[model samples]
Target: MQLLIMRHGEAGWHSLDQERMLTETGRHQVAECAAQIAASPWRPVQIWSSPYIRARQTAAIVSEILNCPVEEKIFITPEDDPGLCLDALLENQHSPLMLVSHMPLVGSLATLLVDGHRRGIPFMTAQAVVLDMPVVGPGCADLKTQFLP
Candidate 1:
C-alpha cells in the first residue's frame, strides 16, 4: 500500500482555526500538487482529509483531479495524535491512500511512518510526501516520492 501525506495549502487567518479557509493562492497551490500527482502513478484511490476547512478544500481539489472520493477523518487534525490516526488508517483497506491535513499532524505522521518517531519534518504549504508500505506501521514504510505546489 502507498500512503500519501499532504499538508493543506496556505490558509488565511481567521478567528477560529476550524473556520479558516484557503486563500486564492492556496487553491492554485493545491491544484498544482494535485496535477503533479495525477501525472504520476501515485494517484490515490481514496483521499482521507481532516475535517478542517482548509484541509477539506485541499482534498476537494485532489478529489476532482484524481477522480477519487474523499472521507473526513477526525484523528487527522493538526493537534491530533498520529498514532491514533495510524490506527484509523489501518481500519480502512484502501490502498494508495491520500491524507490532507495540517502542518504538525502531516509532518509528524510522515515521520512516524517512515522513521518510527514523532519528530516532525517541516512541509511547505501544499507539500506532499509519498510512502510505500507493505503494511502500515511505524518504521515500515519507504519514502517513494514527493509533490510540491
Candidate 2:
C-alpha cells in the first residue's frame, strides 16, 4: 500500500482558522506539487482531505491534476488526535491514498507511519510525501519520495 501526505497551500488569515482560504500563491504552489505527482508513478487514486477550507481547496487542486476524487475527513483537522486519525486510516488501506491536512497533523501523521513516533518532521505548505508500506500501521512504512514547491 502507498500513502501520500500533504499540507494545504498557503492560506489567507481569517478570524476563524477553519475559514481561511488559499492565497493565489498557495494555489500555484499546490499546482506545482500536483503536477509533480501527476508525472510520478505514485499519483494517488484517492485523496482524503481535512474539512478545513484550505485543505479542501488544496485537495481540489490535486484532484484536478490527478483526476482523482476527494473525500472530506473530519479527523484529519489540525487539532485532531493522530491516533484517532490513524485508526480511521486503517479502514481505508485499499489503494494509493493521499491525505491533505495541516501543519502539525501532516507532520505528525507522516512521522507516525514512517518513524513509529509522533516526533514530526517539518512540512512546508503544499509539500507532499509518499510512503510505501506492506501494511498501514505504525513503523510499517518507508519514505518513497517527497514533493516540494
Candidate 3:
C-alpha cells in the first residue's frame, strides 16, 4: 500500500485548538501541494483526515482536486497514538490512501512506519511524505518522496 501523510496547512491561532481554521496562506499552500500530487503517478483511493477543523479544511481541498472521497477519522487527531493510526490503516482494505492530520502525529506516524520507533521527523506546516509499505507494521515502509508547500 502507498500512504501519503500530510500535516495540515498553517492554521490561525485565535480559535480553540480543535476549532482553529486554516489561514489564507494555508489554503494556498495546500492547493499548491494538491496540484503537484494530481500531476503525479500516485492517485489516492481515499482520504482520511483528523476531525480538527484545520485538517478537515485541508482534506476538502485535496479531495476537490483529486476527486476522492474524504472521511473524518477520530484516530488521526493530533494527540492520537501513532500505533493506533497504523492499526487504522491496517484495518482499511484500500490502497493509495491519503491522511491529512497534524504535527507530531504525522511525523510520529512516519517514524513509526519507517524506523520502528516513535521518535518523529520534523514536519513543517503543509508538508507531506509518501511511504511505500508492503504491510501496515513498524519499519515496514520506505520513504518514497516528500512534498513541501
Candidate 4:
C-alpha cells in the first residue's frame, strides 16, 4: 500500500482561523499540485482531509483531478495527536491513500514514519509523504516516498 500525506497550501492566518477560506495563492498552489499528481504515476484510491476549509478545498481539487472520494476527519486537526491519526490511516490503508492535513501534524507524521520519532517538526505546504506497506506480513508498512510541492 502507498500512503500519501499532503499539507494544505498557503493560507491567510485570519481567514484560516475565522473565514476558513484559502487565499488566491493557496488555490493556485492546490491546482498546480493536483496537476502534478495527475501527471505522476502515483494515483490515490482514497483521499482523506481535515474538515478545515482550506484542507477541504485543497482535497476537493485533488479529488477532482484524481477522481477519488475525499473524507473529512478530525484526526488531522491541530488538537489531535498525529500518531493516532497515522494509526487510523494505516488501519484503513488499502493502497494509494491520500491524506491532506496541516503543518505540524503532517510534519510530525512524516518524521515518525521516516525517523521513528516526531521530534516536533513541520512539513511544508502541499508536501506529500508516501509510505509502502508489505503485501502481507506482521510489519506491513514502511515509508516509501516523500514529495514536496
Candidate 5:
C-alpha cells in the first residue's frame, strides 16, 4: 500500500481557532500540487484530510482532480497526535491513500514512518510524502518511499 502524506498550503493566521483559510498563493500551491499528483505515476484510491479548512480545501482540490471522495479523520485534529494518525493508517490497509494535514503532524508522521521515531521534518506548502508499506512476517513494516511537491 502506498501512503501519500500532504501538508496543506499556506494558511493565513488571522485568528486563533478561527479556522484560518488559505491564501491566494496557497490556492495556487494547491493547484500546482494537484497537477503534479495528476501527472505522477502513482495515484491514490482515496483521500483523507484534516477537518481544518486549509487542509480540507487542499484535499478538495486534489479530490476534484482525482475524482475521489475525501474522508475526514479526527486523528488529524487541531491538537494532533502523529502516532494516532499512523495507527489510523495501519488500521486502514487500503492502498494508495492520501492524507492532507498540517505541518508538525505531516512532518512528524513522515519522520516516524521513516526513522521509527519523532524527528522534526518541515514540510513545504502543498508538499507530500509517499511511503510504501511492505507487508511481511505478520505486521512488521518499514518506510519504502517518500515524495515532495
Candidate 6:
C-alpha cells in the first residue's frame, strides 16, 4: 500500500487550537503542494484527516485536487497516539491513501512506520511524504518521495 502523509499549512494562533484556520499563505502553500501531488503518479483513493479546522481545510484542498472523498478521523488528532492511527490505517481497505494531519502526529506516524520507533521525522508546514508499505507494520515501509511547498 502507498500512504501519503501531509502536515497542514501554516495557521494563525487562536485561543482554541482546534478552531484555528489556515492563513492566506497557508492556503497558497497547500495549493502548491497539492499541485505537486496532482502531477505525480500517486493519486489517493481515499483521504483521511483530523477533524481540526486547519487539517480539514488542508484535506479539502487535497480532496478537490485529487478528486477523492475525505473522512474526518477522530483518532488522528494532534495529541492522539500514532499506534491508533496506524491501526486505523490497517483497518482501511483503500490503497494510495492520504492522511492530512498536524505536526507531531504526522512526524510520529512516519517514524513509527519507517523506523520501528516513535522518534519522528520533522515535517514542515504543507509538506508531505509518500511511503511504500508492503505491510502496515513498523519498519515495513520505505520513504518513496517527499513534496514541499
Per-prediction count of colliding residue pairs?
0, 0, 0, 1, 0, 0
- Per-residue CA lDDT of model 6 for 72-131, tens digit only, reads 999998888999999988898998999999978999999999999998889999999999
Alpha-carbon TM-score of each model against the true structure? 0.97, 0.97, 0.98, 0.85, 0.88, 0.98
* Candidate 3 segments exceeding 4 Å error: none
Off by over 4 Å in 6: none
lDDT of each structure? 0.93, 0.92, 0.92, 0.75, 0.78, 0.93
| Per-residue alpha-carbon lDDT of candidate 3 for residues 61-117, written as tens digits (9 for 90 to 100) | 999999999999998898799989888888988779999999889989999999999
Runs in model 1 deviating more than 4 A are none
> Over the stretch 1-149, how does candidate 2's per-residue lDDT look in tens digits?
88999999999996489999999999999999999999999989999999999999999999999999999998999978788878977788547889999989988988899889998889999999999989778888999999999
Candidate 4 has an lDDT of 0.75
> By lDDT, is 2 or 4 better?
2
Tens-digit lDDT track of model 5 for 20-120: 88989898888788777778766788999998888899899889988878999878854588878876776785678898998788877777776677665
TM-score-better candidate, 2 vs 3: 3
TM-score of 3: 0.98
TM-score for candidate 2, residues paired by index: 0.97
lDDT of 1: 0.93
Model 1: lDDT of residue 127: 95
Error of 2 at 58 (Å): 0.4
Task: After superposing candidate 4 on the true structure, give the runs of residues whose Cα lies further than 4 Å from its correct spot.
Answer: 16-19, 135-143
Which structure is stronger by TM-score: 4 or 5? 5
Deviation in Å, model 4, residue 26 alpha carbon: 0.6
